[model samples]
Target: MIQILVIAILSLIAQLVLPWWSLAIVTFVVCFWRSSSALTAFVYSFLGIAIVWLGYSLWVYGQTDGVFIMRISQLVFKANNAVLPFVGTTILGGLAGGLAGLSGYFVRQVTGNQSMSHTA
Candidate 1:
């Protein structure tokens, strides 16, 4: 819960000024600071970013009446389905954040920081 909220809120705010890759940074730092396990870090980070992207994409889809995404869906999928783009966006964001969080967990392990955390 904490990890998800922190990553989602921070990455969302960071994306306004920082680039999209800032999501990676935020997830990495959060996992590095405190995560029970590598899987937990990845799962929490994935959920966090996925939720943000889902909401953001939904809002954009509504605002533009699906014009932008419909064209993208047609181009990429060779069909005009808005759902494809939404799924792609959410999955891509989640994967990026999960991988970054996994990296953080591994790097922290390399630094011998595991002793500080009481893993479940």
Candidate 2:
């Protein structure tokens, strides 16, 4: 739980200060340090990024009345509903973070780290 929070906060900060892909890098590094299982890392990272993206999207939607997003959505996806693009954006961000987290776990495994252990 705490680990997920840490990853989310760090990823958000990095996203704000760095480029778009910073979230993936931050998630990768954090997951690598935490030594989580691939599935656990992916799920947690996906949730963290999805939360951040959705929150930010909502904030932007509130700020601009979502006109720009709606237009872009229409142009790119032919989406009529404003919410659909937001959902797609969140899912895309989650997928990126999840893949990065999974890659981190794999890197750890390749480097001779102990396999992630599950506990009940």
- List the candidates' TM-scores in order: 0.94, 0.90
Residue 56's lDDT within candidate 1 is: 94
Residue ranges of candidate 2 with Cα displaced over 4 Å? 115-120
In Å, residue 117's CA in model 2 sits off its true spot by 8.4
Pairs of colliding residues, candidate 2:
none
Candidate 2: count the clashes. 0
Off by over 4 Å in 1: 115-120
**For residue 80, what is the lDDT in candidate 1?**
77
lDDT of 2 at 2: 69
Per-residue lDDT over 25-63 for candidate 2, one digit per residue giving the tens place of the 0 to 100 score: 988887777745778889888988888898898888889
lDDT score for residue 98 of model 1 = 95
